[model samples]
Target: MAASGQRRPYPQLADSPSTASLLQSTETNHRSPEAAFAQGPRYSNTQSFTSSGSTSWNGSPTNQGVLDRRSYQTNSVSEKFSLPADPAVWGSNVSPDFQEPDDWIHNPDPKRDRKSDRGGSIVSYRGLTNLGCLVVLVVGLLALFAGYPIIHYFTTNQLSNLGGFNLGGINASGQVPEMIGNYGLIDADTPSSAHTYKSFADGSEWQLVFSDEFETPGRTFWPGDDPYWEAVDLHYWQTNDLEWYSPQAIVTKDGSLEITMSEKEINNLNYMSGALTTWNKFCFTGGMILVNVSLPGSSSVSGMWPAVWTMGNLGRMGYGASLDGLWPYVYDSCDVGTVANQTYNGGPAAALSGGDPSNGGALSYLEGQRLSRCTCPGESHPGPYHSDGTFVGRSAPEIDLFEAQVSGGVDSAGLSQSAQWAPMNHEYIWDNTTGNFDIADSSVTQLNSYAGGVYQQATSAVTKANPDCFDQNTGCYEVYGYEYQPGYKNQSGYISWVANGDVAWTLDAGGMVADPETEINDRPIPQEPMYIIANLAMSENFVTVDVANLVFPTTMRIDWVRVYQPKNAVNIGCDPKDYPTAAYIQQYADAYNNPNLTTWTGDTSAGGYGQTEPKNSFLGQC
Candidate 1:
């Protein structure tokens, strides 16, 4: 019989050298394919097998062939050929339960795919997106908060330095200064003194008593024939014209007296109707008096002579008794010529000339002897004359009042001396012992006594010799040879000079003079308060017919009147308590302090900086 177990050669598996070495080294541990393929013999000439029990095969060629065939059948059927086993599977020597190794069942140490693990989670991506959004929000908010104020500062034009309501340091008082008004009447049919006070009613307390009416002696067409009456007649006089009786001259309405004058009426008259008052009527010491007048239309260039002036009552010569020295008298007349050189030959010379030639026909004539040939011992004479042809026509002259106030102890009612005029020249003096004003005693031979010397005079020598040189049309001649310089037409004009009263003095263009002797008779010094007076005079040669009628219904307007005291005379006791109060101060203070609240930073801000609070850096430091 032949053995059943046999070995057979198997082809080697193809592999790299390293894999082949590994497989060879573990060959004893692994099952060989050749050994499993041979199944008929256990031993052969080229193969061998080992088993627990074996059967031996001894035969010749036929027996060997049979044994080989049987072995092939065993190998094919029981081991390799029985079933085509998987290459991954191994057959066990004895068939028990096939179990997987512990290494295969256990996880392969978590294959650690680094690439897959590196990919972050959804939570991380969300967190990154949120952070980016937060950063953007913060940047946007910062931009908004910082940009608004910068744009407002540039559009306005406010200045930086002028911050308050106060103009530098000056303060404005809310009230306007006071201005006075005119109070009078005009009427040609009434008496020249008709407007005079019977019992002072226009803010005054006194009565006017006239010694006489407008009258002239040795006069032709004037109300009186006496040339001496020419003085008063030259002024406004009653007329029989139908227009003279109108109430326009004395209308009292509202709180004032309205006096009106027509251009035509005043054009025909020699003088405008007005009034005069002296210390003799009333007494005022130191207070000022204001007069206001409004011009009719725009006639400011027309000659208006409404005046408020003063005079002394130291001599007597009719109304001329008040005329004392050549100074204040000549000075008041707007004449600049010296009294010393005004004598013609030996007497006072006429200042105007030229008119009718019959009877030495000229504007005016002098009946008195020339100064050079006169045997009279006095320094002056009076013969100021005027003719109708020489009248200043169409030239309207108006006067408002002769207002006077006194300071000397002498009472107006008890005035010792007064002014007066004569047909020729004469002198008048005041006697303190007698308390009377009189002309120097004609009996006196030497003219040295205070009462004997020549004092005032008016001459009519001016004739055709120089019509243009003198104001012939206006009878009044330059007492001092100075010409009349006309001022604005409808407004008040002035004529000034230097004069002598109790002492030497300067007369302002407004006819104001300071009489030092009026203070106290013995001291002969000016007092704290002096008297003032103003009057309109139309003498012989000074009358003009063209505007004589216009003198009625005419008006004299005084814009204002003022008296200035010397620097030393100002009252020092007055305080500044009258200044504005604290509340008023604060009102302006608020305006200056917050100029910018109403507008842009630069718009309302004074200076150059924006309107800032008290604590703001730029403005606070300044």
Candidate 2:
């Protein structure tokens, strides 16, 4: 240790003038050697250590550590203080000063002097970059505009011939094939099978316009109770049926329209059953109708005549109004004044050949004759008009979708309670020569035999070898469909009767025979809007068994009825008319009051003249 006011001898570091000056400063106001050593050296701006001593640590003119001023010294204190001394600790008397080279203390890879990673050379091609982007945009546009439509066509539009392998060849057109009467085996297992009937023979889709699944448990069918249909309560004098139609016999229960017939006395009829109709509420011109029905009683039981059919809207069921003018006339040539065969005065009139247009009737009569040449009483023809205000003629042309009758004693016609013949697909047009409706067209292929169970008859050809699944009783529901396309004013049109999607029967408008006086082949195509009627009628004409022996309380269940039309086709309903007007009620009361009209004896003016029925009856038009 040096004296308190004296300087200590320092090591001689190589030729460091700055270190010598730093050490000479420490000689003034000198701290004790122990105090100076403990305080260490102050760090300079360059992070090198320096001291204000009488001599530099390197024994230079100033006291300073021998370190490179260009960079920081990162060595440990022991390494920095390495000196040639026996005890090399701090404050030890070291040997002569020796400065370390800049390379030893200056880091070769200092963090601040590192090279950057983003030093690659940039290449430029302006035209090539633009062209590549344009090509990508064009490909995306093509995929959106051209490729999308092609994919959509293949996915949405079904084609039968392009691939040549013939998928759905049996019914490639997707026109419903005439289904076998197999009680519901095929359809019950697959509810989606109904979609198979949603197409036409022309490969067009059918838009469902009306459908009633009968799903509501307590939905009623009385006049104001239903939106689309109504139940009737009357004796069907047109068919001379034995059963009286009562609204109470119709019910919606357990997801079905259950129409039960029982032995009862009503309107002088011993048996009572049910009937439902769309009538004036919902009528369509030309469309397809599909019904799922299980007919009441077995086919072997006689007096069982259950039918699902359509009649011209001009005639109301159970009403004597316009019964003569609209009962079976499809063409204007069969109007009342037009002379045709008739049982008008209890027998066929002789040579009723010419239309007496000079003779006309009331306003109701005139509107009913709008399609005919007959003159009426007023200019306000009170037409039960089409929605387009066209004259809706009073002609009740009939098309039977399905009509089952037990016409034999012991399944002689090969139609038992379990198995039956093909349903009666008959189209009745007025016959001028016969004074009544004649079966101008019918689908009775090879009648008197039960040979065609078939593998889904898609065309008109019958397949007879295979046994059909028609063994189920009346408990099972079967699908029956009818499709009609009207002609364009004497042009050709088409009609088809389908059973369970099979084309059981098909006929062109030209195939139907119109009245000879009409002189037009397409006149019998039923161009007028028609309403639907479903009834379980009891008729003695087809009965081969005793009425007392036949089962009582027989039932018919209708699962649903759906009406569809070709997309964008002309679908018109009955013209708007205030039904059951005071005038109409008066006319109906007058008719009912006439004792000669015994069929309407039960009706009364106080009872609103049957206006209290499931639907009000129009005096002249529907």
Best by TM-score: 2
lDDT of each candidate versus the true structure: 0.24, 0.49
Taking the candidates one at a time, how many backbone clashes does each contain?
94, 31
Cα-based TM-score, every candidate: 0.21, 0.50
Q: Candidate 2: where is the Cα deviation over 4 Å?
A: 1-196, 333-337, 340-371, 376-393, 409-474, 488-490, 513-522, 570-572, 576-622
Would you give me the overall lDDT of model 2? Answer: 0.49
Task: Tell me the tens digit of each residue's lDDT in model 1 across 1-622.
Answer: 2344444322222352222233332237643444334333343443233431342334345445455646654654454334346543434433334433356557334456766456766678789799889998887777677554554556555532211211221111221113221111111222443323211112332221111221212212121212111112122221112222122232323322233334335435523333232221111221222233232211211222223443221211122111212112222111112223222333322322212233231222322111111112232222111232111100001111221111112221000121111111222222222211112222311111222112222111111111111111221111111101122112222221111101011111222122122110111111111223333222222222233222333443332222222122221100112111223223333322332222112333342223222111111121
In the range 1-622, model 2's lDDT, one tens digit per residue, is: 3334433323224453332233333335543333223333233223223334442433444423333211223332343344434444433445645333356446343244226325444444776788889999999999999999988988996532111212211111112224332112122323454544455567677655556677667766775555456788777775578888888888888888888888998888788999998765566678888888776775455667767788766556667643333444444332332222221232222113222222221101111222242323233233444454443443555666766655544542221111111110111122223321122233432222221111000112121111121212426667776787766225646666666545565555554443333232224456556778888877764455457557878887788887777666636454324211223323455432232233222354432223221110122323
Alpha-carbon RMSD of each model:
37.4, 17.0
lDDT of 1 at 178: 30
The runs of at least 3 residues in candidate 1 whose Cα sits more than 4 Å from the true structure, single-residue gaps closed, are 1-272, 278-291, 296-305, 313-318, 324-530, 533-552, 558-562, 570-622
